[model samples]
Target chain A: MSDYILHCFAQSGNAYKAALMLELSGADWKPEWVDFFNGATRQEGFREGVNEMGEIPVLVHGDLRLSQSGVILDYLVETLGTFGWETEAERREILRWILFDNHKLTGYTATLRFLRFIAKTGETDVVKWLETRATAAYAILNKHLDGREFVVGNKPTIADLSLCGYLYWPDEIGIDLSPYTNITRWLETLKALPGWQHPYDLMPGHPLPCA
Target chain B: MSDYILHCFAQSGNAYKAALMLELSGADWKPEWVDFFNGATRQEGFREGVNEMGEIPVLVHGDLRLSQSGVILDYLVETLGTFGWETEAERREILRWILFDNHKLTGYTATLRFLRFIAKTGETDVVKWLETRATAAYAILNKHLDGREFVVGNKPTIADLSLCGYLYWPDEIGIDLSPYTNITRWLETLKALPGWQHPYDLMPGHPLPCA
Candidate 1:
C-alpha cells in the first residue's frame, strides 16, 4: 500500500492525465474514484478532505494535498526527475502549449462537446460553434506539428499527454479531422506509448482513433 | 539587468499575476506589452517569440519560456523561496483554491460577465444567468474567506493574488459585493500592500489590484 492516494473520477480526462503521469513515473499510489455524476465532489467532507474547493485529480501524499493536473504533473516530474519531454528551452515551450491546450483548445472544445453530448441540451448553434473552435484549434496544432513528431520537440511529454486527452475526442462530437495530417500522425505516435492504450481502452464509448 | 523578461498585456489581470510574482521575487525584468485587443498577438513573429499560441504573461528567464499563470506562479514560489502564503501542509490547499479560481470562479464569472458587458449579446435571461453564477462564485469565496485574512491561511500567497484578480472586477460588471463582506474585507487588506496600488493606478479601468 503506497502512502500516496489519488482522488478523481475514473473517466475524467483530467483524472486520466494524473493517473497516466503516476504510471509513467512508476510512483506507488492508490487511485480512489470520486463520483462526478453523483455530485460527490460537492460534498462538504470531500471538500475539506482535499481543500476548500472540492475538485478532483487531487493527490494526497500523507498530509499534503496537491490539485490541478498541471501542478500535479509538474510536481511528479520534478520529484521523479523524469524530464524526458524536452531540454531546458523546450520545457518552456511545452508549458506554453500545455497552457494553450487548457486556455484555448480544451477550454472551448471540451465545453462544446460536453454541452452537446453530456448535457444533451443547448442551442443548435453549438455544433457550428464547436466546429469553428475545433477547426481553429486544429489549425494551430497543425502548424506546430508541421515538421515535428511531438508538441514541443522530439519526445512525448506531459504537454502531449495533456493535449492528447482532448484532441482524441473530436470525431465523437462530429468534428472533422481529415485536414490535420501532422496532428493525426502525432496522435498515432503518442498512442504507440505503452500506457497510452489504457486510457483509450478505458474511456467509455471510445471514439475511433484519429485517421 | 536581470535575465528575466515577461511578455504581457499592460492591463490584463492574468498578466499582472505573473508580474506581481516577479516583483515579489525581486528579480530584475522588463515588461514587453503585447497589444491583445488589436490582435498583435496573432503575428507569427510575436507568436514564435514566446508562445506559439500567443498568450501573455509568458515569462522568459534565461532560456526558459513559461506560460500559464498558475504554473508560472508555482515556478516563482519554488525558485524564489518566497513561501509566505501558507504552511507546508497548506501549500497544496492554496494551490487547490488557485485551480478552483481558474476552473470554477473565473470559469463561470467570465462567461457571465462577457455575455453581459463585452458581447452585450446574451440578453435573453442573461441577468439571471449572471446572478446565479456570480452568487455561486461569491458564496465559495465568502466561505473560504469567512474568518481568514488570506484565501488559504493567515498569510497571503500566490493563491490570493490569483483569485483577487477575478473578484476585483465585480464593480465593473455590476456584481453586488455587499453580501460578501469577508471577501470585501480581504480585498481591502490585500489592496493595502506596498506596490499593491501599482496595478490599479497603472491600469485604470482594469479590475484587479495588480491588473
Candidate 2:
C-alpha cells in the first residue's frame, strides 16, 4: 500500500501541484483518480468523505487526510524534508509566492484553460476577462523572475511547484508563453529538475475519453 | 511611531485582512494610505518599491516589508503570538482554510464586488460568471461554518480573519447574506470579539473624493 494516497486526476492542474511534488520528492504515493469532469467532486459522498471543500488533490496519509494543494505541499515539505526553506525569511518568501499563485496565477489560469480548452467556451466575455487577469499575473511573475533562477532562492521550493502547476498547459490555456521570456526560462529551469514530470505524464486520467 | 506600518486603502479587503489582525491583536500598527483608486499601485515606483506583484496591504515592520494578506496574517501569528495554532495539526488546518479563502472565496468575491459595486459594470457576462463562482465559494464556506464558531479550531484564529475579509460588504457585493445563516452567525461571533472594526472604519481612503 502506498503511504500517501493523492486524490487526483491529470486534467486538474491544482491536483498536479501535489502529484508533481510527491513524485519529485520520491514520496511513497499513489494517485486515486477523481472524475472531476463528471461531477465527482460535486457529489455529496465525496464532499463528506473526502473533503468538505469538494476540491481535489486531497492527500490521505494513514489517519491524516489533507486538502488544498498549498497545505499539502507545505505538509510534504515537513514530511519529505525536500524543497523547503531553511530560514524563516526564506520560508515566508516561498509562502508569499505560493499565496500569489493560488489567488492570482492558478486562480485565473485554471479557469481560462477550462474555458478555452476543456469546456470550449470560446472567447466569450468571461474568457476574455480571465485571459486579461491571467496575463496580468503572468506579467508579474515574469518580471519577478527577471534575474532569479528560482522563485525564492537559488534552490527550487514548493513556491515554484505551486506557481508552475497550471503553466504547463500554455497551448491548452490559449496563452502565448513565448513573449514571457523570463517565465519561459524559469519553466525550463524547473523542467530540468531531476525528478520533474509533466502533469499528464505524472498523473492518471489523461487524454480524456473524448480526446 | 507605530511599530507596524500597513500600506492600505479603505476599499481593499485584502488590506483589511492585515489591518483587522493588527487591530484585533492590539498590535502597534498604523495605516499608510495608498491611492489605489487613482492608480497608485500601477505606477512603476509602487510596483518596484512596495510590491513587485503590484498589490496592497504591504506590512512594514522595522526593515521587513511583507505583501499578500495570507503571508501577513501568518507573520502576525508569530510576532503577535495570538490567533495561532498550538499544534502542527492545528496549524495545517488553519492553513487549509486560508488557502481555500485565497483561492476560492476572496479570489471570486473580490472580483465580483469590484465589477458590480466599484466598477459598476452593470451585470455584464463577466460579472455574472464571477457571481456564480463567488456564490459557489460562499455556499462551501457557509456549509463549513455550520457546526463551528470559527474556521479552524474552537477559538477564533487567523483563518477566520482571512475568510471574513470581504464578507462584511454583502450589499456592495450584491450577494444577500440572509440566506447563509451559518456565515451570518459566524460573522456576528467574530464581531463580538474584543476589538473589531469594519474595513471602512479601520483603513484610510474611505469616502472617495467624489463621494
Candidate 3:
C-alpha cells in the first residue's frame, strides 16, 4: 500500500486534479478506483465512509481523509512541498483562482461534458446553456492568462491544476479550444511539466464499459 | 470614510455573502452599488478596474482589493477575527464545504434564481434543467445540515454564510424550500444571529427599477 490512496475514476476530471498533483510531486500514492458510473458515490455506505458530499477524488493519507479537490490539492502542497505558493499574498491569489475555477470553470465545463460526452444528452437547450457559461469562464481565464505563464505567480500552482482539470477534455466537453489562444498556449505550458499525465492515462475507469 | 468598501448590488447573493459577514462582524464597511442590471459588470471598464472575472462583491480595504466571495469571506475572517476556524483541521473542513457551495449549491441555485426570477425566461427546458440540478444540490446540503447547527462546526462560519447567500429568497429562486426541512431550519438558525440581514436589506439596487 502506498502512503496516499486516492479514490478516483478516469472520466472524472475533478479526481484527475489530485492525481496529477500527486504524480507530478512524486508522492507515494495509489489510485483506488471508484465505480462512479454505477452510482457508487451515491450509495449510503460510500457517503458515510468516504465523502459525505457524495463526490469523488477522496484522498486518504494515514489518519487524514480529505475530499474536495481544492482541499486535497492544498494539502498536497503542504505535504509534498511542491507546486505551491511562497508568500501569503501568492497563496490568496492561488486560492482566488481555485475558487473561481470551482465556481465557474470546472463548475460549468464538467456538467457540460457529463451531459454531452458521458450521459449523451445530445444538443439540448441545457447543454447549450452550459456551453455558453463554460465558454464565458474560458474567456475570462484566457484573458487573465494573456501575459502569464501559469494561473498564479511565476510557476505552476494548485490554481492551474484546479482550472485545467476539465479543460483537457475539450473534445468530450464539446467546446472549441482553438479560439482561446491564450488558454491553449497555457495548456501547452502545463502539459510540458515533467510527470504530467492526461486524466485517462493517469486514472482508472476510462472508456466506460457501456461506451 | 468606512474602513472597507464592498462593490455590490441588492440582487446579488454572491455580494450578499460578503455584506452579511461585514455586518455580522461589526466591520466598518460601505456598499458601493454596481448597476449589474444595466451591464455594469460586463463593461470593459468594470472588468478592467473592478474584477477581471466580471463579477460582483469586490471588497476594497486599505491597499488590498479582493474579488470572489470566498476570498473576500476568508479575508474578512482574518481581519475581523470572527466566523473563522480555530484549527487547521477545522479550516480545511470549512473550505471543503465552501468549495461544495461554490461548485454545486450556489453554482446551481444562483443561476436557477437568475433565470426563473430575475431573467423571467419562463418555464423553458433550461429552467427545468436548472431546477433539477439545483434541487439535487439542496438535497445534499439539507442532509448534511441534519443533526448539525451549522455547516462546518457547532458555530456559524463562512461556510454557513456562503451557503446561505442565495437561500433567503425562495420566491426569487422559484424552488420551494419547505421540502428541505433541514435547510430551512438551518437558515432560521443563521437568521437568528445578531446583525443578520436579508440580502435585499443588506445591499443596494434592490427591487429593480423595471420590476
Q: TM-score for each prediction?
A: 0.80, 0.99, 0.99
**lDDT (Cα, tens digit) per residue for candidate 3, span B7-71:** 99999999999999999999999999999999999999999998999998899999999999999
Give candidate 1's total backbone clashes: 0
Using Cα atoms, each model's DockQ against the true complex is 0.31, 0.94, 0.91
TM-score of chain B of 3: 0.98
Tens digits of per-residue lDDT for model 1, A47-108 = 77665555667787766668777667667776666634546556656665666666556656
The per-model lDDT (C-alpha) reads 0.68, 0.93, 0.93
Task: Kindly report which residue stretches of model 1 are placed more than 4 angstroms away from their true locations once superposed.
Answer: A2-4, A24-30, A61-64, A78-94, A122-135, A198-200, A203-211, B1-6, B22-32, B59-66, B71-95, B107-115, B122-137, B198-200, B203-211
Tens digits of per-residue lDDT for model 2, A54-83: 999899999999999999999999999999
Model 1, range B1-211, lDDT digits (tens) per residue?
Answer: 6667777754566777777767755767677766666677788887787666566677877767777787778777777766345454476566666666665566556656655665566554545654675577778788878878888677778888877765666754568888889988998987777656445443334443332
Q: If ranked by DockQ, best first, what sequence of candidates would result?
A: 2, 3, 1
Indicate the residue-level lDDT of B5 in model 3. Answer: 98
Better of 1 and 2 by TM-score: 2
Candidate 3 on A119-182: residue-level lDDT in tens? Answer: 9989999999998999999999999999999988899999999999998888999888999999
Which candidate, 1 or 3, would have the higher DockQ against the true structure?
3
| Residue-level lDDT for B21 in candidate 3 | 96
i-RMS, every candidate?
3.7, 0.6, 0.8
